[model samples]
Target: MRTVRYEVLPAKGTEDKVIAHVPRDVVVTVTASPVKGLEPTLDLATRLAAHGYRVVPHVPARLLRDDVHLKDVVDRLRGAGVADVFVPAGDADPPAGAYGGALPVLRRLSELGSPFDHVGITGYPESHPLIHDDLTVQAMWDKRAHATYIVSNMCFDPRLLGDWVGRIRRRDVTLPVHVGVAGPVQRAKLLSMAAKIGVGESARFLTTHTSWFLRFAAPGGYSPERLLTRSAEALTAPSSGVAGLHLFTFNQIAETERWRCALLDRMTG
Candidate 1:
């Protein structure tokens, strides 16, 4: 079960592109942004669901207004037949309401009888620029009870990712991990799209996951195949608890899906 993430931007034909390219039943997780608000995410999820995709819209804590708003959002998603959701602490400086981070929102969701079948929380393999490693690990431990799975943020180094997964298991967090990797994309186009959507936050993410970008930008440099080959052992190991791939398509749906299919064919050929 592969998952793909997409930013909720105002680009035309984004949903159409996704429908045309993305295979049905693959979970498409729409990203929530402080700049774009949550409407687009929710709307896109609904549209995708109607098109027979298992859509998961990110419910960022900072964007939510309150418990009431959370309930309303849950109701809407339920009505749309969405069974999965991912929660992240958004980049918003001042949160929209009581929820300051994903923990509180997740706790609230639990209190609401856990509306969704699968609740996902973010994990970091490398050190976060703003947060300490210890706190990030502890946060995962604390949220383990509420979340059904973990979706790791984009990480370039396979060794670092394997070590991070081992550390999480040692800390007693057993959530299945969906390793994040960038789908096949040109570095220039990815950066261009990110800049158009939200320069500040997107740039920060690129900085964090820049290794692959730098290599990809260089002539005939590193590719997703190399990353997968390097990481395959740890990801497939039983002890590692890796569940699946979470490709950061960056809205390059057509190209990403094509790459995915080609990779699958080659692997099974």
Candidate 2:
């Protein structure tokens, strides 16, 4: 079985839920909220690390004020013993600082001698809502040197995910990819959040693709088994270089853990 990383929002009540339901074995990645800012994210990460869980905190570039702010954030995480961080060009309108994207922040991190052991950069399997497809691909190529691995944006189609891996490899961006998939979540909320943002571009693909509703919104809700099973072949292929799974929990910590355990039982059974 591949490693699993559970992504949680640094929202109110989330810390308690994670400490309760998410096992220490699974890596927990705390997300940076544009509305709440990075303070909550780092705070949650520090607390989670204190709880003995390996945590990866999102350090969105647009959230920082400048290089000094970036240093402070890095120092804070290092002090808290956070070894991994996921850097994305944040969606903060009127960015909080000099960084408008992740590249500048990533460069600064390297210049600071990169305190974290692992750093992840975003990958788009489908067309970005704003960035051109060619540019998105080229952006991955550009970031290959700075990031340690790639965690792809949420993608429902197995074919698209496989094709994206192929495309990136062809472009010589060979970082292992951690396939991003949504955990068990309420269909209604998932669709609504899909129109906005979460850990990935799930909103654009799920909302814009009308036909997905019937398939994803089964009587229960969106379940990741079908997608993950279908993705196994591509993921395990020698050339694919898939590192593991990154589940966008959407703060459904308990349900996500239950579903993951059940699925693993089925696979083992």
Candidate 3:
């Protein structure tokens, strides 16, 4: 079965609204960046767990200052019965603490002997604004042993993603991948989510890459209609090594869910 994962971008009470719409069988991952402070991380994870979703909250490296902080995070997640976590370097400007990158955090997590059944890291199909392409791939390799899977950043081009996945597997990094793509979102709504979530870095990243914006604005901003066919073709190939799909819904939970259901029906029919 194809796996569908929903990203929960922390918004004020948006969690309640969003989670209400998601089916229990769908995997929900809470984004750590939006929660801002430390407390929200555990709070949101707990809330999601209470609501019956298998939550995978992000654990950003920059957010933790020391071993103590790391332990607290792990303890909290374990307490909430969370078995999966997505670790990213985060967009926090000027490191919040000693951890400069995800690799350091990955090593530390392994040292802590976390009980999580799965650990996820990020992959960029398009280049990240601050990090180099080579560095990003190396980071994946460096963290591969500790990570059970990879969740890619948003990408509009299916070709780029297919090629990127091919290249990653060729390099011998065989971690299962959750290909990330934005859900059926309106342009204005996407930007609003971007602005509200403080995704200035991502907005800048998108703007700098004119092709990305141009493609999104071309006709249908980002409908999964064609995207899924192309993505599925790529993922179904044995060499692709992709495990699932991660949708950045931009909080268009209702529409995204509708689209996913329709797609699932089509596939079943």
Candidate 4:
């Protein structure tokens, strides 16, 4: 069976809806902050685990004030029966305290001797607006030992992803990759999300330096079929170093789940 991982933003009143509809066995990871804070992350993970899903919550290092905060997070996750987590240097400006980046928090987690089975780190197939490509790769190298896998951020090109996989393998970064793709999202929904999530800067840097806003605003919109098919191929290939699918559901749960089921049928049929 193909695994589809869903990304959930830490929004008010969203936990119930997401947990109600999301499949039980698929991996569910919570965003550290769709807006900001640790409360939502812990809350969402607790709900997901209650619903019988293996939940992974994002721990934004910058948000943790100190070792005490880090330990509290670990303890909370452990209490929720969470065995997996995703650590990233978040978009938090002027980081909270000692932990400004993922490296520091990952080191802290290791020192705490937490028993999480899987830890994930972000990968950029598309370039980040402010960060250079070399630094991103180096971050991956720095965090590989702590992470069980790499979750590539949204990229519209599969060839780019394939090339990235090859590059990662060559670099001796053997951590499995969860190829990230936007799910069957409506055009309007994507634009709405883009607006809230700094779509302008995101598109300018990641989406070919072209006007993604203009593209989304046009009559004909976008579909991720090309990228998904290519990713499926890449994942199926031997030595590709790919693991499974990570769907950026954008909270359009039903459509994304349907898309996942249809793809599974096609692949198995």
**Segments of candidate 4 deviating more than 4 angstroms:** 197-208, 211-221
- Scored by lDDT, the top model is 2
TM-score of each: 0.92, 0.93, 0.93, 0.90
Instruction: Give all candidates' CA lDDT scores.
Output: 0.80, 0.84, 0.79, 0.75
Which candidate, 1 or 2, has the higher lDDT? 2
**Per-residue lDDT of 1-269 in model 4, one digit per residue for the tens?**
36668876666666776766777788888876525577877988888887788998888887888998888888888888999998878766777878878898887777777468889988887777778877888889999877889888877667787777777787788898888777778877765775565321333443444654455456654567756665666667779777787887777777777777787798789
**Predicted candidate 2 versus true structure: per-residue lDDT over 28-57, tens digit per residue:** 998886778899999999999999999999
Off by over 4 Å in 2: 194-200, 208-222
> Once superposed on the true structure, which residue ranges of model 3 sit more than 4 Å away at CA?
198-201
Arrange candidates, best lDDT first: 2, 1, 3, 4
* Candidate 1 lDDT, 13-46, residue by residue in tens: 8798887887775778888778778888899888
Clashing pairs in 2: 194-203
Q: Compute the lDDT for candidate 1.
A: 0.80
Give the residue spans of candidate 1 off by over 4 A. Answer: 1-10, 195-203, 208-216
Task: Between candidates 1 and 4, name the one with more favorable lDDT.
Answer: 1
Model 3, 113: alpha-carbon shift in Å?
1.3
Residue-level error in angstroms, candidate 3, position 126: 0.8
RMSD of 1: 2.4
lDDT of 4 at 198: 30
